[model samples]
Target: MTERKLKVYSEDEAKERLAKELPHWYVEHGWIRRRYRTNSWKGTLMVINAVGHLAEAAWHHPDITASYAWVEVRLMTHDHKGITDKDFQLAKKIEEVVQWQPGLEGGALEGTPQDDLRFAYIKYDKPKA
Candidate 1:
């Protein structure tokens, strides 16, 4: 299949979209970025692996910077030399997969127990009121 041409967004435009569609993400330098706080090195690695899987599936990779307690994902359309739909799409997917909490869904898939630090991973962002 032929690839669709990507439209690059200006800084202002990128920030506007991020505000509306990706509230947790921000534009920095030339990339749209989001930092995920983790509980420990294990959590950080989990976040990285999740992002990597989504990025690879989408065929659009983000630059990842990870430490013991956090992971930062930076996305830009390298070929387009700017932010584009590809970046936003991939970022959204990464956010969705990384922040998912099955326990909150009222289903059988209970998420990690909050009482146990050993079971903890990503420090999920709470919804803003």
Candidate 2:
């Protein structure tokens, strides 16, 4: 199914954006948390650069914290007032770039243990004709 693109229409256009785009990341204290794991500080910086580029291109900005292993991004839409649509859009864009944990990027596996082990019960599988 296609995902619904959330709407944003507020004076604080940028703030509004965060509510939709980074639903999971955008939080209290007037900040959104975006976490990404990297091989080193250099890699982390590269991602920050990319995110910066994204922010600039979108004409929206975020406060970012970077370290050797991780980067935490905080987005707040300053123009429209509070959590505008643009913020959400940018959050989605940012989500495309970073990942914190492995094997859980998109989703987890859905098959039962029998799917992996041979001679195991395969209820999901049908008898061959």
**Which consecutive 10 residues in model 1 have the weakest lDDT in total?**
120-129
Off by over 4 Å in 2: 1-24, 99-129
lDDT of 2 by residue, 28-99 (tens): 565455676665666677678989999999878988887776777776666534555566668788776543
**TM-score for each predicted model, relative to the true structure:** 0.95, 0.56
- Cα miss at 88, model 2 (Å)? 0.7
lDDT of 1 by residue, 20-84 (tens): 99999999999999999999999999899999889889888889998999999999999888999
Separately for all candidates shown, the number of backbone clashes (residues 3 or more apart, or on different chains) is 0, 18
- Candidate with best TM-score: 1
